[model samples]
Target: METLFRICFFMAMMRFSAAEELKRNLNGVVGGNVTFPDPVLELGFLLGGRGTIALVNDRKLQIVEEIYTNKLNWNRNSGLFTITDLQKNDSGVYKVDSKKARVFYISYNLTVYDGAPTPAVETLTVSSDSCWLLCSVDKATSLLWYKDQEVQNQNSSASSLPITVHKEDRDSSYRCVAANPAENKTLHVNVRTACGFNETESGDNPKQRAYWSVIPAAIALIIGALVVWRVKRRLSEKRQTEDYAEVQINNENPQDGTFATSAESSDHFDSTVYSKLKLPEVTSAEPDLQATPT
Candidate 1:
């Protein structure tokens, strides 16, 4: 009967010890630091399952693992343990055990991840009234779109998400966030600039609208002036060629019967001139011949 009582007492003590242990979830980033909230009072810090990494006994700190030689630190006053330059493989269950067993045991499930990349915002389409935007990130755990400070949309398992913004809200702020459990990155955006619109929110003002229109108007005038100048130059050259041909035709001697000019050439000139010559009469030719015979 005494042996049965001893077994019952031992089982009760084991149940009490197991009930005192608590667990928590924590996250960390690669190359970054994390502090375990468990305050150390002569405690042993172990990694994974029963692998001692650090210990604080008799007010002296001892680092047992070679990997955590300089990376782990213990604060006596604050009684906190910190690890720096975390790696992805460092993610696991971390246990802190009290030497005297007076304090409850606490274990942390630490998850370490690489740094999150900043999301890129793309303008898909824009009209006079609204703009369509898309946000993209690589290997992100989640993507979020924010208008000002409020989240407008989010996707947990997708690499990209889309949002529609109205032109009336063009003056408001916008951003995209790519995040994992351990890290997050944000990218700010200006809707007006992203949508390729140069007009301001006060674009309805007549003076301001005209101010923006002046540049394009000036460019159009310059292009028109150049076209007109080129056309006039071509017409002037044609007129000069026609005038030269007329001068050459007028210089020819018409009496030589060498008017080798074509009809096409004469039609080019305004008018043409002609010269006529008459022979003297020879009525008394026969009388001269009779006198010579006598």
Candidate 2:
């Protein structure tokens, strides 16, 4: 009797092992789809903690649950079942049973998660020769920073990760990744722009900044030259005016308009008039002297 009891216990353990062997695991993200393995002579499909959700009769699929009417699909040609637009609440153990000569069962453990959010990068601090960056995200299981193709830093449980880059690598490509078991999102970073040493800065591309800096100096030089030219022009004009004045003074006639030349006097003789005054002199003195003598 003890041997028979041991034999029964061994058979039960084997059965448990067989059942465990039929179980599979699956993962899906929100707004994504998952497909189950094909089944032959499928009888019914069940969800753990719930009643039957679907059945197959005469090779035709029929969904008994109204909740899965639009979300579930069964392919008759391939005998495959697919679920679309999965949600977090849809994660559970799913079972499908079939009957050929005897009953066969397969179960899938499905896990649905929210899609990982896209990572956001921020410049935390910047030194003269190095820069610190932070990568942050939500609803993600892991965050990582990559410089080129190499991993620079990573965190599995944290939502944020930090990394430092040198000035020499400012132009190198970098990416931030936020990931879950089901999906991942990546953000590309322009290292030069993110580190505040972009092409517009004099330190990064000296030619570009130099090109702009030279404009003001060039403009100033042009203005200075213009001012000098204007001053020289004014001085030249003043000198010319002085020389013209000297020439005019040296060549000006001395005679007034009232004074007539010989030609004019001859032409206007008829219209000319003259006046003169004379005084008596020696005859009066002689008469006085003679009177004295007499």
Candidate 3:
């Protein structure tokens, strides 16, 4: 009875070892290459079960299956398998067995997806107080929302999620993670202060406010320069007119030892005018005759 129990126990151990399944998950692009991990070679160790020769998908390596005829490659030293130009139809369970022991050495479950789509964020609605944003993808098994690289929503499991943006969150950055069992994609959105918010009443960041202030500041500087130039021009013209009036007054008063030449007054005269004055003339001989007679 003891010997029988030992044989039963050995058979149970064998059954348990045969029932063990090794799970491996892998992803590949539509037309990309994928390789299965190779089992480590130990000096005296056998993987999955004791074996001498390796068999793939229950077929001898020498006799390649039709599905893997030209697409499969194997490395003898590493015990690794590579498939080139992966197709959607090639996604399934791959098994490697030991020919001598007739037990599985390793099994791999591979799932191939077409490709991960690029995620995009869109603005749906905007109000004075808040804004609504949406992140979408063509197809996804789950969706994740992030704000500033931290997870925001953990319960979202759809292709799209609506994100609420408050006035205080103007400068916050949002991200979306769309994923499936095969692949995942991430997209980001930067929220600016001008997204339907009241920018004049304290909704902008320092940089944005400074940027907007530059426009008015530049306009003010230009206007000030124009005003200064106009005032200077007016003053210069007034000074020139005053000088001209002083010159005319000097010219009109002949008693002042200043005289205006015809060349200088030609520009101001419509036509030339003439003035006459007379003075008495005396002889010195009358005084000498009177003194000699006296």
Which rank order by lDDT, best down to worst?
A: 1, 2, 3
Q: In terms of TM-score, which candidate is strongest?
A: 2
Model 3: CA > 4 A from native: 1-19, 22-29, 38-63, 98-104, 154-157, 170-172, 193-294
- Which tens-of-lDDT digit does each residue in 1-294 have in candidate 2? 999999999998898679756888888999999988846454555455487778887888888889999998887777778889999999998876666543457789999988888888899998777889999876546888898999989888777898998888876889998888888889998878788776435655877878889999999999999999999999989665544211112223334213222222333245643322222334433344445444
What are the Cα lDDT values of the candidates?
A: 0.78, 0.76, 0.63
The TM-score of predicted model 2 comes to 0.64
Clash tally, candidates in order: 0, 0, 0
Check candidate 2 and list the clashing pairs: none
- What is the C-alpha lDDT profile of model 1 across 45-75, one tens digit per residue? 5455548888888767888888898889888
The top-ranked prediction according to lDDT is 1
Better of 2 and 3 by TM-score: 2
Instruction: Give the runs in model 1 whose Cα sits over 4 Å from its true position.
Output: 1-21, 42-47, 100-103, 197-294
- Estimated TM-score per prediction? 0.62, 0.64, 0.58
- The worst-scoring run of ten residues by lDDT in candidate 2 lies at 244-253
